[model samples]
Target: MKTFACALAALAIVASAPAAFAEDRSSARKAQDNGTRQIPVCRKNLGTVAIIEPDNQWWREFNLGSPEAILRVFVQQSRCFTLVNRGRSLQNSAMERALAEQGELQGGSNIGKGQIKAADYFLQPDIVSTNNNSGGGGIGGVLGGVGGLFGHGVGAIAGGLNIKKGEANVTLSIVNSRTTVEEALTEGYARKSDVSFGAGGGGFFGGTFGGVGGGGYQNTQIGQIIVLAYLDAYTKLVSQLGGLPENASAAAPPAK
Candidate 1:
């Protein structure tokens, strides 16, 4: 009887272990989700907003195109304001009537004239990134040298030991298009470090080979830092604007 009772107790513990672990994982995921999800302060929807392509020096330097499209993703996700296409052109009454006629044939409602909502605010994003080296030289050099003995490819892969740190700053502004006044401004900053390995080596036959390595560093990319800065800026922008009352009924000038 004693032996049977001990066996049952052990089985019960084993069965309960997985459940406890699953519960822990679930709790952790819930905590992470709560941390990441942004809750808008203003419950009511604000009026439409137009986003302008920023004159991005940082992106230009990196040969990346404008971040205006990326900014749109953040704005739309925030749900604080409706987004309108900046490229939308004004339509005349004749065009509206023609569209309405077409709609009637399709069994759809008539297209009303001047139904397009004008943007109440304009949002502009400015971003800048800089590199700041905090000391140099580490085990990365030794590992790089070892990889160079094998081949260029090996050295390049091992070069990931090399570290570089970068910082980025993003600024977002809200402007009242009608008043031409800046209503709110917010800034976000982020820092990240990247592991890079040196490329280029002599052929396996002759010549000299070189490789570079670095000390231990955080495994973060410069692009990730820039993106984080943008996300932070977006969060701040949303929080700032969400504090205002809904402006769905208000009219403002068109964005330029």
Candidate 2:
């Protein structure tokens, strides 16, 4: 009995090894390192940027929160621009000012108007579209052909083996806040394939996006695809502004 128990424990550890290893190679880990994309660093600060999402609420379809969450991560990590709060956090700041105006706070609170930093540029993220299952070779049709030779039961079992591909098209744009001129517009795309339900796929969300807080981006398949797409777009945007080749990285020269 003792020997059997020890054997079971050893087997359990061995069985779990691959999963642990795979987790380490997961996309969440990659995202923390900014995935495969190299972030370009600017020697001179571009300007204060405010990240905003589209008004369409298209992300609601995928159960995602806001693109601002991840976009801000890229912006801050790139060290290109100062980020200003213009989203939900802005409302919080407004509430505080309202409180100060009501004299509901202590003296010298120093909460007042004109203290807000002006955004020199507006960085916006938009999801052009997403294809949850694309480029599939008609699983049903192949299975039907198989059924003619291998019988219905075998074909049905084989039907369970499906190859699914997901893709997303995302864009990032930067505009001069004062002049309201579009400075740069870049598009990014990412595609991923899943072997099937039993195979355990997707490099993203091995367990979670981990420390950086992925929000819904860590929880769903389409969300992960979108994250990669956006990362691609941001990469291009930075490279364009830095005058580097697309998807290339280098130290940006000081602003003239």
Candidate 3:
């Protein structure tokens, strides 16, 4: 009996090995695909770029996760174009043009699902709201339905359930040659936030569905300000030395 138990344990270990390695490989691939944070390369000459790589993980989850990811795309696109002669440089204008012509970027990997550039900008924006804005057990509202599902009580501390069942806009703000918020998204803000909810219902009270089974609507602003600052920092770095190419985008002004 003991020997058989030992063999069973060994078999369990073997069976679980692939699942563990699969996660590791996924993380490694994700990191590899995301690449590093370096200056952007926008050459003077209009031609092919060699690398033109795209971060599959980030692009899949959320394009332009941080400003750095966007910068990577710009540089890679330049590199790939340098190799393939797809374009001469990287510019907001170029990006906009690509969307106009092909409904997506001309050279970079697929970023956006809808009309959004996905990596560099938002196809839509996010908004905030709540249905339990009443008094009394309104505090219980936030903690009631949805909380029972995701099993997260964090929102409960913030005073009732502040929900955002409304829509969100994705404001695709880009840094100009000056590294300021240039090219205000012409298509207006894209949808930035869209979360689903359904949990925490009668189930917790011996009901089958569990908890407040109808936790609807939530929103995250995505804070346009954060994006603006992120772009500014990236542009500043690219302004100096510039490992890739020339000042196709102009140098960022000195900090005060």
| Candidate 1 per-residue C-alpha lDDT over 119-224 given as tens digits, one digit per residue, 9 for 90 to 100 | 8789887643333343343223323333333356444433442335455556788888778778788776665531121211111001100111111111124444
Q: Return the top candidate by lDDT.
A: 2
Candidate with the greatest TM-score versus the true structure: 2
Worst 10 residues of 3 by lDDT: 1-10
Extract clashing residue pairs from model 2.
27-203
Note the Cα lDDT for every prediction shown.
0.48, 0.59, 0.28
**lDDT (Cα, 0-100) at 97 in candidate 2:** 97
On TM-score, who's better, 1 or 2? Answer: 2
Compared with the true structure, the alpha-carbon lDDT of candidate 2 equals 0.59
By the TM-score metric, which is better: model 2 or model 3? 2
Higher-ranked by lDDT: 1 or 2: 2
lDDT of 3 at 123: 16
* Residues 1-256, model 3: lDDT tens digits: 0000111111111112334555666543433222211223333432222222222212111212323333333444323122322224435546666675675555565444363221221111211112322234432442343344324433543334333322221122232323333333321121222211121111111221122122111111222222222233333322332232243233335546
Tell me how candidate 3 scores on lDDT: 0.28
The candidate 2 region of ten consecutive residues with least summed lDDT is: 1-10
